[model samples]
Target: MLRSHDKCVVYIKSDDGEKVVDEIKTFQDAHWVSSPKALWRIYEFNLTEMQPAIINLQLHLPGKQAVCYWKKQNLQSIVESDFVHQTMLTEYFKMCPIDIEARTYLY
Candidate 1:
């Protein structure tokens, strides 16, 4: 389903499932990350925090969107670069957005 959108999908499992999903959406709504390199940096930096339950990681190009899913608790987290650090919780949810348009545009 996510693959059809042409956006990067990275799913992650967190201590709190609902909170993580909300956080991801917040970041996506803001329109973050200008390039793919920045997105990769965010993923490498945050990988440690998202461990164990975070079984699957999907990264779609063009859109620079990531969807992170958990294997154990069925938790999902999405992160994009557009989100600003308005609060502590929001700050922690920061991520890079996949450039979906770029992929489709080229294809």
Candidate 2:
């Protein structure tokens, strides 16, 4: 289990969001949003535990990158971006999918 200090927000987008959300639900301490988009979902998990989660995403959603996003930074940007109901995460996520995943994995 991930410690409190490791808590972070995760935005998972797959060709199959429902399946991904279902898969994520099996993870410890994961909480999904009440509503889900057709091909994307938002969740929160501990930083350390997320590796396996990403691995699972790769296994199940092959060829898709599992991106990890920082809640506070993006949250600030989300608030500053346009003032919507946290949809900025999804929009920005879609805009820069490679970036979110690359930096997290490479750096």
Candidate 3:
């Protein structure tokens, strides 16, 4: 089990339904906010002014990233050119899909 210093609960599920793990105190050791520029754009949208909208947005972001790969559309370049298009893309490839079975047999 892992726990955050702030006492936030984190859960991890395995591909097989056999393992259900609970995480207890952890630290924000990594910078999840990959692009500061993108975050700044969100701030520019004045989310603080719209409390409900901001809350809803935060809730949906993680699920959106999981099924979508936004990294393929070359977001870094796009953001560099236009600071406004910083929102995560829904149709782009965020990560390369891996074949677990193939990897297991390799070594």
Candidate 4:
């Protein structure tokens, strides 16, 4: 999209007046109708292609993991729940002590 000695003229409008600027840069507007990516987005097509993908692993200390509850739920009951105390990190720690296979892997 760019070539040597190529420059673009931009006109900016403000409360004061219109100002003209000359700059050499790459400008892309995905929301514009002229953009192919905009058409793909409008048709609900895949926008990105990634290899292996991405994953989120939650790590927290004991009794410090996140908990989801409704407004009507009692805080005391939620704190006492078994699921509230367990997290992926805590489970891994528990498994490493009992399962010899788990001890072989690094955290």
Candidate 5:
């Protein structure tokens, strides 16, 4: 089955990184970056629907600027992006064949 949820990362930056991090926790999960380059993987909303919230990241942070990175993705691409996850996922696939087809079944 096709995964309908979109993915994104919200970068919240501030002179007060700690405060920003704490304040940011008030928001929903699966939307903020996990790395230093300001990555946020937000699955709370689909691509077009999430644009406004991503834009608001800039306004939401205190005494700093923010950014958002959004990418359309599939299971393979998501797993491939992370090395450790990729390794484990590759192993899992070797042991158990994925019932989901690699691509959409279409004309």
Candidate 6:
């Protein structure tokens, strides 16, 4: 039977022979305690947040890209909206020439 306050014992062998060490054995502590990033996550803190935000590029043939529209919305109005024609890929291509920094990134 184990006592209420008793900790798990670990045995280590050295030149002096085997030595018993009392410890609160846990896989979580062993894996996460030594890492700063893991400790930050243990405290439930956000490690990284996108600054400018990321853009997901969409691929499609000309005039075949998907568009967002409500069921009640007219098909003609949906086709007329300027946003329907604009995708991340199109915007990236449009901005690449104008913005010098954009040229550094590969599509």
Q: lDDT values of the candidates?
A: 0.41, 0.41, 0.40, 0.66, 0.38, 0.68
- What TM-score, over all chains together, does every model reach? 0.16, 0.15, 0.17, 0.44, 0.15, 0.49
What C-alpha root-mean-square deviation, in Å, does candidate 6 show against the real structure?
15.6
Instruction: Give the per-residue lDDT digits (tens) of candidate 5, residues 1-107.
Output: 11223434345568767424433443354343435323333433342454223321112232222322347646565444544233322443444545555223221
Candidate with more favorable, higher lDDT: 4 or 5? 4
Best by lDDT: 6
lDDT of 6 at 52: 56
What would the per-residue lDDT of candidate 1 be over residues 32-94, giving only the tens digit for each residue?
455664776777766236433333333244344443445664332223223311332332233
Q: For model 4, what is the error of residue 21's alpha carbon versus the real structure, in angstroms, after optimal superposition?
A: 24
Q: Taking the tens digit of each residue's C-alpha lDDT, what string does model 3 give over 1-106?
A: 4444333444556788565543222234321343654677777865337533332222235233223236667755644553343333421222213544433331
RMSD of 1: 21.5
- Worst lDDT run of 10 residues, candidate 4, spans 23-32
Q: In candidate 4, what are the lDDT values of residues 9-105, reduced to their tens digit?
A: 3455567786633333323421124467678889988767655444354877667788989999999999998988887678878999899987976
**How much lDDT does candidate 5 score?**
0.38
Better of 4 and 6 by TM-score: 6
lDDT for 94 in candidate 6 is: 96
Q: Write the per-residue lDDT of candidate 2 for residues 20-54, one digit (tens) a residue.
A: 34345444446333343312334443424544344
Tell how far residue 62 is off in model 4, in angstroms.
2.5
Any idea what lDDT model 6 has? 0.68
Off by over 4 Å in 5: 1-7, 16-107
Question: Model 1, residue 18: what's the lDDT?
Answer: 40
lDDT by residue (tens digit), candidate 6, 61-95? 88889888889999998899888899878888899
Candidate 1: what lDDT? 0.41
Residue 5 of model 4, lDDT score: 33
Winner on lDDT between 3 and 6 is 6
Error of 2 at 22 (Å): 36
